[model samples]
Target: MNPALQGLLTIIIGVGGCVGYFYFSNQFLDKVLFPASGPNAGKNINRANIIRPWLFLLPALLALGVYLAYPVVETLRLSLTERLPDGGSAFVGLDNYEQMLDEPKFWEALKNNMLWLLIVPALSTAFGLLAAQLSDRVFWGNLAKSLIFMPMAISFVGAAVIWKLVYDARPIDQDQIGVLNALYIFFGGDSPNNWLTIPFWNNILLMIVLVWIQTGFAMVILSAALRGIPEETVEAAIIDGASPFQVFFKIKVPQIMGTIVVVWTTITITVLKVFDIVFAMTNGQWETQVLANYMYDKLFRSHDWGVGSASAMIIMLLVMPILIWNVYNARKEMQ
Candidate 1:
């Protein structure tokens, strides 16, 4: 079948089904169950009215149950079971969790993820706030913002590929191609450094990729928050002998602090789930392992479903608090 025809048929069937269901359900409630013209009609009508909203909501609730809730429950189940050689799963309780804790690589990945959680969101938000402030003061501000934000349009793997070349290494005797090596040699360095191969610093280098991508997102959001600040507050600060820095930090930042926090937590969630950059650049080699890649390595490469699911649960646990906090803040603001 033609793709467009299939899509059109899907739309027609979906809409028609929804319409038919609602109409028929309402008729059944009024004519059969509720019986609007009969005795006890008022009570029946009240009952139907109360149940109507849930009827509309039932499809969505079921969809969420199937898609979102099921995966979490299934993953939790998988985490607690050992994959047997006979294509069966045997319940092993917390053995997977214990084994994961015993592994040095798991600890290393957790440590690197902690480093990412600490660095990426903070650096991205700081850079974004700085750029948001500075860009507004420049004549070519929009163009500058565009240039800064261009990296956000690039995929993580694409950005990794781009930076991979920038960090690329050539032998000392050959003409250097990598930007870092070329600069190093120009400054009288003896040998070209393979930047990604260095352990602790390599993690920082990989994090720079995510920071570069996320800064623009932070900037755009922070920029809007900045613009929304009342001019009178800034003017009042300036009139009271406050310096530019004082006005910005004391007035503007306090006002947009909520927005700043939202951006930070948003990026933090991204950092926790970071995988592609590490996967593409180092494949979690050179001590740059993050939780997502760690989970992938366990689940796919090692074919250890139990340990892999445990790692996944750990990542979810880390993210859940931040997710809940973000939603809480949003609801508070709405209220």
Candidate 2:
């Protein structure tokens, strides 16, 4: 069979199968669960009709269980077992957890992760808001928005590769190589510094990459929010002798505070799970490891499934509170 024809036939069959299944299921359910609900009890209670949409939700729930719930349970179980030499395992309860607490490298990774959480969201949101506010007062606002949002179009791995070249270090005696170090040397600095090898500064540099990528997302969201601010509010504030700063902080900010929190919390979760940039740039070397990097190292490099799982679980534990808060904030906004 022609490959294109085969693929088209497969898709047609799959879609037809789904349609048939749903139709049969709905008919069976209506006959079994909603057979007039004791005709004497109801002339026509609309209750059964209201539940038709829910009949279609079972497949989604099953998919969620297989993809999300099972792995989580398995990871938690793996965290308690030590990977034995012969591909078997030894159950060592809480040893991995205890070791993780005492390990200096773990602490360093945590510190870097914390720094990421602290810096990226604030800087991204600030830069985003600044760009958003500035874009509104311009003739080329769409152009400006496109430029600011361009970074988001790049994949994380691609962005990391681009920055790797930008931060690349070469011999000082040779022509300056990396863009940043080139500028540094042009300013009379002695040597091309290995920006990825420095301790705290490398973390900051990594944070800059995330901020660069996420600022575009922030800008797109916040630009909309800023535009949504009622002009009357700004005019009213100005009529009351309020300055631009006052109108921004007191009037515009108050209305958009929920969106800001949502953006912050959303990025905070990403920061917690960040592995690619650190992994690509430094491979969790030079104390620049975050939780995600640490998890990768434990699982793949050291082959310690237990510790890796514990590390992953710890990351999950840390992220849950923020996730709950984000949900609460979202609900409040909806209300």
Best by lDDT: 1
- For model 2, how does the per-residue alpha-carbon lDDT over 70-176 read when each residue is reduced to its tens digit? 98998888888888889888888889899888999899888888888889999999999889988898999889889889988888889899998899898867875
Q: What is the Cα root-mean-square deviation between model 1 and the actual structure?
A: 2.9
Model 2's lDDT to the true fold?
A: 0.86
Model 2 TM-score, 2 decimals? 0.86
lDDT at 55, model 2: 68
- The residue-level lDDT of candidate 1 at 299 comes to 87
Pairs of residues at least 3 apart in sequence or in different chains that clash in candidate 1: none
305, model 1: CA deviation in Å?
A: 1.2
lDDT of each: 0.93, 0.86
Model 1 ranges with Cα > 4 A deviation = 1-48, 330-335
Using all chains and alpha carbons, the TM-scores for the candidates as numbered come to 0.88, 0.86
